[model samples]
Target: MTDVAIIDYGMGNLRSVAKAIEHVAEGRAVTVTADPAVVRAAGRVVFPGQGAMPDCMRELDARGLRRAVLDAAHEKPFLGICIGQQMLFAHSAEGDVPGLGILPGEVVRFDDARMVAADGSRLKVPHMGWNEVWQAGPHPLWEGIEDGARFYFVHSYYVAPQEAGLTAAHTDYGVRFTSAVARANIFAAQFHPEKSAAAGLRLLSNFIRWAP
Candidate 1:
């Protein structure tokens, strides 16, 4: 059986993500781990993270699993969620922290403009709620999920990949931002699947069944 490793780097909503993955794993071996050896040996890797960039990076490095994550990203089907996805970029405006640089881009904060809807009410920062995600490209991870599907989001910042083609899906707040991305063996999302309900579950299912 192919083993799925949900990296426990001490950040992310590990329990929720692990439970969600386990719920859909069917017969696969799913492990919530911080061990480099376990991560290296897994057939697939799920990288989920929350909280600030600096702390997340600190924990990942403190645990000495940075190299393991990089290796997994290169050698296996890797799924990066939220801060896990943000950390894949070259840099982040959040605390000016540097990222893994696996994907060419920088993470940026939503500008401090006083955004207002046509109804004239102030739009909130940390964009927490269900928002529509428009597909920017096609990938196996998006299977069965329709374009313009609503996914749950909770963040004050978003990724801005240098390569426009890297964006797999986008969402609009005051501005349009990349909500999901894909390349080679990596597919990542800025939303929390465990909190996203049905469409989120479907996306997780697709990830488990994804061959590439």
Candidate 2:
């Protein structure tokens, strides 16, 4: 059976992600590794991250897994979550840091002026808790998931791909932003699937069975 590898770059809740994957992984091996070799060897890769973009990038390079990550992203079925999704872009306004450049886009923060609900209430930054996600188009990762499902999210920054077609799904905070992206063998989401209850589990299960 093809094993699933969750890249441990020392950010985010790796254990929660690991446990969640293990729950839906069936008999497939789920290995959380900091080693580049293990990442390259795995059949599928889950790139997950949290915290600031600068720190995330620094730690990734510090561990010498940058090349391995890029390779796996290009060569295998890949899933990116939270900061993992942000890091895939070419740049981020968080620390004005450059990303993997795997996708042509930039990560931007929610505007303070626009952080208002329909009721004229102030919305907080980091955009925590559950929000509805609207599918941009059909995707394998979205299988078994409803078009507008609520997923757990906790981030201030969101991705804006130059190519609108790259967006797999979007969510509204202060504005409509790309909440998920899909291209080739890769699919990424700004939300935390592990924390998203039944809908989250369904998405992970779809990823496990997804060929691409």
Candidate 3:
């Protein structure tokens, strides 16, 4: 049974992510839960988030899912989306906050100097809407998706993994930033797959069937 647990720490778009997973789950069970037991027992885990880093971390701790998340990441196929991806790093510049330290890196703000497009148009902070992602290397989750496919994004800060080899995909905003990362059993995306349409769905579907 492909029992997948979407960790509900009170910040992510839980329902949307659950629905997407359910769409591709086939016979797998999908549940949005904050219970650590449920998270620990699931075959796969998805950590999705939107909003402030401190708030996300607070809720994660409040719900007592931090350790459960770490445990799950270590033992099974784990996916993190948006700020869910940022939190995996060592820290964040958003609120000068500390993250899970699962990955060796810090989350930093997009540089203020280059928030302008090449065509001389001003760009927004959230970096909302569609952008193309360049695959850095091969991985199971990227299987049916093209090398440069657009995905939905909504965030101001981005991850800076200490080691470059961990990066799975790259995207150009004001500056180039890490859009996705994959290493061993854990994979994460700085963009929101539930809102990313086809390419997003392909990634989610791959995550569902992924044995890694």
Stretches of candidate 2 above 4 Å error? none
Residue 165 CA error for candidate 3 (Å)? 0.6
- Off-target runs (Cα >4 Å) in candidate 3 are none
User: Which tens-of-lDDT digit does each residue in 123-169 have in candidate 3?
Assistant: 88988899999999889999999999999999899999999999999
TM values, all candidates: 0.96, 0.98, 0.97
What is the model-wide C-alpha lDDT for candidate 3?
A: 0.92
lDDT of each: 0.91, 0.93, 0.92
lDDT of 3 at 183: 86
Candidate 2 lDDT over residue span 91-192, tens digit each:
999999999999999999999999999899999997999999999888888888898999999999999999989999999887889999999999999999
Model 2: what TM-score? Answer: 0.98
- Which has the greatest TM-score? 2
Worst 10-residue lDDT window, candidate 2: 1-10
The positional error of residue 141 in candidate 3, measured at the CA in angstroms, is 0.4
- Minimum summed lDDT over a 10-residue window in model 3 is located at 1-10
lDDT of 1 by residue, 49-100 (tens): 9999999999999999999999999999999999999999999999899999
- Estimate the lDDT of model 1: 0.91
